[model samples]
Target chain A: MTADMTTDMIADPSGTRSPGEVLSWSRATLEPALRGAVDTLPGSLRHLVGYHFGWWDERGGPTGSAAGSGKAIRPALVFLASRAVGGDPLAAMPAAVAVELVHNFSLVHDDVMDGDHTRRHRRTVWSVFGVGPAILAGDALVTLAMDVLDGHPATSVLAAAVQDLLSGQSADLEFEDRNDVVLPECVRMAQQKTGALLGCSCAIGASFAGAEPVRVEHLRGFGEQLGLAFQVVDDLLGIWGDPAVTGKPVFSDLENRKKSLPVVAALTSGTPAGELLAERYATADEDLPGLAALIDEAGGRAWAHQQADALVEAALCDLRLADPAPGPAAELTGIADLVTHRDS
Target chain B: MTADMTTDMIADPSGTRSPGEVLSWSRATLEPALRGAVDTLPGSLRHLVGYHFGWWDERGGPTGSAAGSGKAIRPALVFLASRAVGGDPLAAMPAAVAVELVHNFSLVHDDVMDGDHTRRHRRTVWSVFGVGPAILAGDALVTLAMDVLDGHPATSVLAAAVQDLLSGQSADLEFEDRNDVVLPECVRMAQQKTGALLGCSCAIGASFAGAEPVRVEHLRGFGEQLGLAFQVVDDLLGIWGDPAVTGKPVFSDLENRKKSLPVVAALTSGTPAGELLAERYATADEDLPGLAALIDEAGGRAWAHQQADALVEAALCDLRLADPAPGPAAELTGIADLVTHRDS
Candidate 1:
């Protein structure tokens, strides 16, 4: 899995590249391949999915700016893991598309639930298309994800992958209203929400390539760990990163009184600052600056960062164990670095 | 088809039938089967899906009023069609549940879009659970629906069914925004929105039983025609049925500007009444009396009923050509009659 050999990675001929450069390169290559599948949609539907992906203008024309399509991190991990397991990354493209579609479906619906107006620096699907069309679009995407997976290698394996995605999504939803959500609960949610898709990506890739059972299991473990690490890093950035880089307002989660991993950890941390932060969060909409201050003072931020570091280390260790093909494995290693270190 | 044989047509021998009696009976029979396939979900997720189905209340206790699961029309169609094709209906239960789950998933999302507060005479999932969780619930249902099909039948057939579902849903979303909808387009929308699922239901049922291609084609045709007729009749009811009996506002389609089939037909009718109906429909609001009078005076309601009658006749004609197995075919005939005639 050598990143240097990948066409997507090759787009940056400049010898010097930042971690962000790696993320963008991985995403850039993956986007068109994904768009290829979406382009196959009926013309009426093709534009709608395209709009949701932020590739189309409001009137359903192409927008030209390809920057806002979210980091295609999950798909890249999938492609990398596929090559790592000795499979062609292209063979895993459908599975990669499936996982990404599922992720976007969640985002569209989440925006509606949170009453959010903007995503990727523009109006959300619900905001632009209205709630009915937005819900239908999300529904269509979910069905499309499964439809994409239908061409996967075997019935049994595909069935298991579908089950994993559903179970993960179910757990993530359950955690939303729960005021008592704990670190363990959040970890479990991570497994379902992120880990399941990652695991499926690897498993489907391995199955498509006809890898042995031992290799499939090993790749699955690598992806599960990597997915958890990815979520941990995302949670960290959600609270502590710059608004400009993340394309989100500072302390946005606190404003929504969301119960992310860090907030949950602080609530049960048992320190005075932790207690104060918990009290502030309990009120839902206390002063945003004061809440951020309490969370930082409580050491919640540090604890979250430390946890992310540990998980990333664990993920990398598993990646080594999977022993991927040279080209894809190298890409996976770089992605693991990018995932854990991203400021946004 | 014998009215006595179809479950819905039978008077409750137990004398316990209620508003959601069919829904309750179907759930009791279906849940165990679904649980058998999805055995690995962690406890919390298992509970979340459970509550979504109304087997449990919001706090995770059994909801005493568990009767209102849904109409179960699609699943019952699957089972009945399987039987009518000389296959074991029990073997097709997975397919039945899968189709029903997808149907319910669409309904939950649809309710949110339409801003309808009640379903089955109870609060809709989105209204009760909030939009985010409802979206997740809908997503989980779709994922599970695919999984259910993935395990029992031919993988290729199941995959095709999922693809059709997605394509259909995508068209449904597009239709909502287009004001120039006409009869042909409405028929095409009906095929995508309703006929496709029913066709898949029959196709999967045949697949589950490993029926011959000829038999599968016949059942598919039967399901498609029956579904089209069902949608046509529903359009009539939407405009003309008594609000009290329908559990929906009278001329709900006019009020919401739903672009229903009769409305499309009326728009194309070019009669003086048709022209007036169109004018009022375009600006539908609380002037319900005026709108209702316009539709009745313009012959839109009568025209809708006639169109439904024609479709029902055509559907029955198709069923006759199929020569379905006597017992289940008889049941489907009766079910079709019930569906087409019901005010609701």
Candidate 2:
């Protein structure tokens, strides 16, 4: 094994590792199996997948860097949720790998739909590999995700989440051409698009751990609420995040006029600034910074921050209801906190 | 129930039915459950899927005709394979529905990749719905296919076929940019692209029928060879079938410079006509009829016809080896004949 792969296997003697350490350890545990699954892909698709995962460059050469890999938050959720229910995190490795694959599959396709040029400080898969190959890459990942489950009872769980995810994306695309998107509809879209998979990650993890129906339900509730919080925070990042940290153009979502949570909230809010922002949005104005200021002035930013905090608190209540083991509970709480508070 | 649906449920008084009768009966047996699964999709995706299935127009109104729906050949294969193994075809309805969903999923995505605007005498899903929604429609169909399996043993069977299908498509996309693709590689691509799912259809159906592994394997062999024959005939139709019958523009494959089996066979034939055809294919010349004539002159057409005949013979041998019941066996034979002999 390479040094990079082995180093993360050496767990800290300390019991209370930070969320970052937890994520690193989870990724280390998940990599071998994930790579093995991807390696089974056809050569043409394997190259694009590896490049998307930051294991290699576009030419199939090693990049010698892991900076392009995302934080792998979903896999971490899977591992921690399994451990929280008093199961060996190792037992949930397939669930972890499957959720991560599903997450990346959505990312690859989302980039194609949004016409985004960059991700994780590198060219997006569609931008680097062309649209057709990128679509195939996404298709391969989703198929592999189902295959990895290998008829485990959790297959239904994952498949339902996938359907919800696709439905959410369909709504997102439909909203692009409309001006009357309400907050409830927009929130439902976010839940389906982002929350469904996250909820599936926790539920599947707990199910793999042989948890009872009640515990799995509670864990799913926790993950679903946290997922909404994550999406709310993501909208915040899309508008005002530092470009260097987020690895996207400043005001990227606004540039595409995405009907994101914050923007929709502001559009539906009955304020003068809200009206003004809507007008500018309809006119194809290039004043993105000006529009961002208007959304903030219209109370969209504050409403989003409030929603994230409330959702996170609700998620913690569900976590407690699950009666999780103490150590993993603490780690899950820390991860949840990090999700809402992260700058990117 | 609607008259259209109830009409085909009536059994024939005679002991025999034509291949067309078998297909229509399969479609009738499969529609309610198939529509049930699709109706579960979120509204936005459901509309697009229904339109693509020829149940509705783009505005979501009834089409009042089934002309645009392609033959449910895969489902027919599934149902016949089940009955051939002495199981009730109705008992294998889920398998039949799942395979047909997978078939249409591939078609929806293939249209996007090939930029095909027309299918079955109508506009394709992508052409009518736009690219992003069409992609989601394809995603929904494939996900629904697995969901319809619902943790059956056939889940892995379907998943494996999906991977091979994606790999075949990847190879096809790669071939579009290269001139050195050989005959073996091209045939492998066709087998992966077309044969894998058809084989899976038969195997899954036999499995659902509680057939032994040996019988299932033989049935799969039958379907795979038949699938190759089906593809070879499809390539032939792409070149020479009348547009009024094929529902494609004249010389569509040659117009796109598709490296189909016959074209690749001609390119590697080592004949003077083959050399001339290769030279012509290298340019931007629009003499599609001339290209078609050259491919025929190079013996590509004859070779493909011979191969299709050989494959059908091999397929029949496998069918007989499975020890199928006489009635379903005859129907299967008729379907295979129709596949290899149809103009469109």
Candidate 3:
């Protein structure tokens, strides 16, 4: 993750970087521009946004540590996708910042909706600032994302992805109240919720690189598949990962009765264990570990892992189809592996 | 308000149209375009937005009436501003729709933040559809507003206004917990929250018409002053207007202990009534009528009316500075009168 490693990996055509190194480089390239854009926000919103980004404590002092700042995965994808299309990564800096801002905006609002209190090992924006200010902070971030684009041709691309993201979130909320959500619709919801923005990140990066539409579409396909894989891995982590590592309570998703992909698959499996799991889920039962066992017995765990592997493979296929530069393609592959394999 | 009257009024250079006629014409011209843009929203969000606009009932059926739809005042400003700049109002249709969408987006989110249950005689979007969906619907709308601009040169103008609007809202929420709020900052908040978008609507409309920057700035000045006047009138209405016409509970602002312009003015007036009002306001006393009387006794109401008159005069002076065409200028003046004088 050192500067020398980044330089060496990027300069050598045959060298590949780890996902951590790629993210480190991306964050280094992105943070200044990101902060500059955020600084343009009005003072009140600027303070809340900085707090949410883990750049400062709640009272606007420097946090003195980068403890809760996210992994910068989306911005990394944007920069790498630009480089894959043979563009200087700096040319796509605005796109990268916009994507990151949108991601954080969704995180802030989603925390309020989901009623979660923690993320990335820190108290969430709503938990600390109150819901009204949190909502305004989210609004300011999304607005700033568009303003940073400054009438670029990619504005429509970003807007469409935002629409899809909102629709996906709408569907996800609706699913919470309904007992009859099917597997296909749940999958579609996940794609809309998570895949759209990731796909947009790649497509926008390529477009910023002046890539042909075909290449941009392929890059988008690559990101969409990877995003689905990431979600699958995330769902698995939500259920089984160590609470300390994940920065969330153990079985928090189950406690909320979130219809994660694995849970939905288990509910619709038509196995005896699936029926038992459903009966337990309908009641106020608190046996989260037992429910996890039933989902495993219903083959949900295996199905999710298989989906992740297949999605990642498909994402790699799209990466190849985009005819990316070999070095960036290798780094993207590394990132995909990390996304599907990481514990948190 | 009739087709023949509208045609006759527009055709006759010497004849002037009423504000109601101007608004009717604006609504007629704006509705289809606004609906078309909203229809592009994903179905889930579209449903909620339509409900918010009073286009349909919660079940998605026609309301069988247009009883609760807003007056479309912002869209009227956009159109009139363009026409005043000697451009065909039709050319500014997208800007009109965009301004209207931003206005509604703010309204939906503001209702959630303000915790109001009703708007325009119906349950608010959040109250009817749940807060999460309401927030999503607002997000969809602002995104769509930017998308409607579609790389237009005016996108930055709209974006800046959105930022100001959000900042003003943030300050407003902050002020709710403080007792030492001053008159000047309260006025600045109103200018940011209400004046900015109105100014933006005028500026964007004129820009769409290819008006020079000077004219655009003048038009913006006109709108900003008018907006401040409108806010003062609205604050007055919030305290004293009939519930049937204003579509809100009587003395609602006092009930919420809202630090509205007139209330703040009275609170800082250094009168005995002001001191007594402050003491009563800090209590759980439910005497809203008594509170209203204290505000009036403290000179809040008369001061507000004087301010409104001065602001409208200032707005008209700016309109004259823009060198607007005579016919549209008359209509704009009419609309300004309506805004300052209306009961609702």
Candidate 4:
């Protein structure tokens, strides 16, 4: 949470400095272009977007720019992937900005669809402006993203990614209503919703640098697998991470009855614990801790963690195909470590 | 309403074939690509889109493809303008499909934002599939539009138009909250919301054909002016046209308390009828026909019709600059006539 990256704000138990610190370095360079592009939004949308970024308080009061949690992660992929491929990070700015804008547009509309009110401890755009304005603002951001991708062949990559993102989101929403969500279905949904954009970011950076198509596809594969791995690890933290460190209650995802990877895994495992957990879910919110334990006992947690590790390994293989520089490649390895191993 | 394009369905008062007939001609070529693009939407979205396009009823009952009113007009502009500029209309099919996709994207989101339940005499996507899916489908369509526009420099033009479209929609939602709306402000909003995509369609057709910048600009101006003129005429009809022709309860726009062009003009005129109408708007929806009369008495209808005439005149001047082929040029003139003079 600290502006100064040297502070051990994001640390591993073994005490090595996590490469997650790369986010702040990229954020500093990416901030001006992001703000300038957001400023171009018409009328009150400038304020709504400002409010979204936490640069301003909900009532149109300026709060200066606050880093949106995990927002910098995708853009970090765009920048570091550029550098890893021997491309200038600054030249990849438009791709980076467009990726971030695309991410925010999804978030804005997602909140409206889910009726979510707050994120990063602030009111959502739909919560502040009416639904209509927020929807239009999201539309404007998509327009801006397309505009930024202009003159670059990477626009096709971004568009395909966006379609994939929406497809995943649609499936996720559909999954919420059915108790029949299987593990592979959940994983594919996660990849579609989250991995596609990450994949696009990786490919678009190389694309803007005029990299060979084969190398670009390799980077895309690496980022996509990395994204799926990251989501699995995040779902893990939502359940079992220490509240004192993570600041979220234990079994957070379970309490909300989210059909996340682990939960879906346990529910469809055909084990005694899985059956009990599924039955309990249909009832009230009682015994959330027991449900969490059932998922763990049913091997859901271990299964998810193992999948994350395997995906990360596969992602590393793809990263090798891209033939990235050793130094930046090492940073990517650190990022993978940071994603899969962060205790907090 | 009928399959026969030769029907006098959208007849001008004088016994002549309406240029709305041109939509059928353009639809012949554009429909296949348009359906193929929409089919790329994942899973249930294909069905939802099918419903939105009137290919299915609410229960997924197959309906033969029905013409979506006004949906074809923008694509028609794209195809006709391409031919008008001496480009082969067949070569402009991608631009035509892209424009229609963009238009439908707006329509889907606009219905969700506006909270309307029905469009095209059928259930809306949100009402049937749910809001989340509808919103996601709209996002998917926008992505599809960008994908279709790929490898074309007209992509930038489409992006800019989408931005302008969003800007207009935002201003419109904002204007609904404020009591003061001026004539010029309303006109600009109309231009932004309606004119932008229309202008985009016109220019994209030429851009696809590798038209010079000056010709593209001229065609864009013509389309934009024509859009403004169309809105003016439509607004005039909302106030004074016979309900039997327009298919609405008398004063439907006024009854819904919409801040439409004529209503805004009459509200801001500073005349006695304007003051009376303004006071009436603050109260209940009683006497909507009377409110419509006040708009007429305040010179709102006459002024709107006059502005429409002027804009069409100005539009024709720009159309001449494009130096369109005579046959296609006549079609454009007929379209202008049909839009301005339609009773329905």
- State which candidate has the highest TM-score: 3
Over 4 Å off in model 3, which ranges?
A: A1-14, B4-15
RMSD list, candidates in order: 5.0, 2.7, 1.9, 4.8
Question: lDDT per residue, candidate 4, B73-147, as tens digits?
Answer: 888888778878788776888899999988899989988877766566566789888889999888888878888
Clashing pairs in model 3? none
Evaluation by DockQ, superior candidate among 2 and 4: 2
**Clash counts for all predictions:** 13, 0, 0, 0
Interface RMSD of each: 4.0, 1.1, 0.6, 1.5
Better candidate number, 3 or 4, judged by DockQ: 3
Assess each prediction's global lDDT (C-alpha) against the native.
0.67, 0.89, 0.91, 0.80
Ranking under DockQ, best-scoring first? 3, 2, 4, 1
Top-DockQ candidate index? 3
In the range A264-283, model 2's lDDT, one tens digit per residue, is 98998999999999999988
For candidate 4, state the interface root-mean-square deviation in angstroms to 1 decimal: 1.5
What lDDT tens digits, residue by residue, belong to model 1 across residues B252-277?
76667777776777667778877876
DockQ of each: 0.40, 0.71, 0.85, 0.59
Error of 3 at A240 (Å): 1.1
TM-score of chain B, candidates 1 onward in order = 0.82, 0.96, 0.97, 0.90
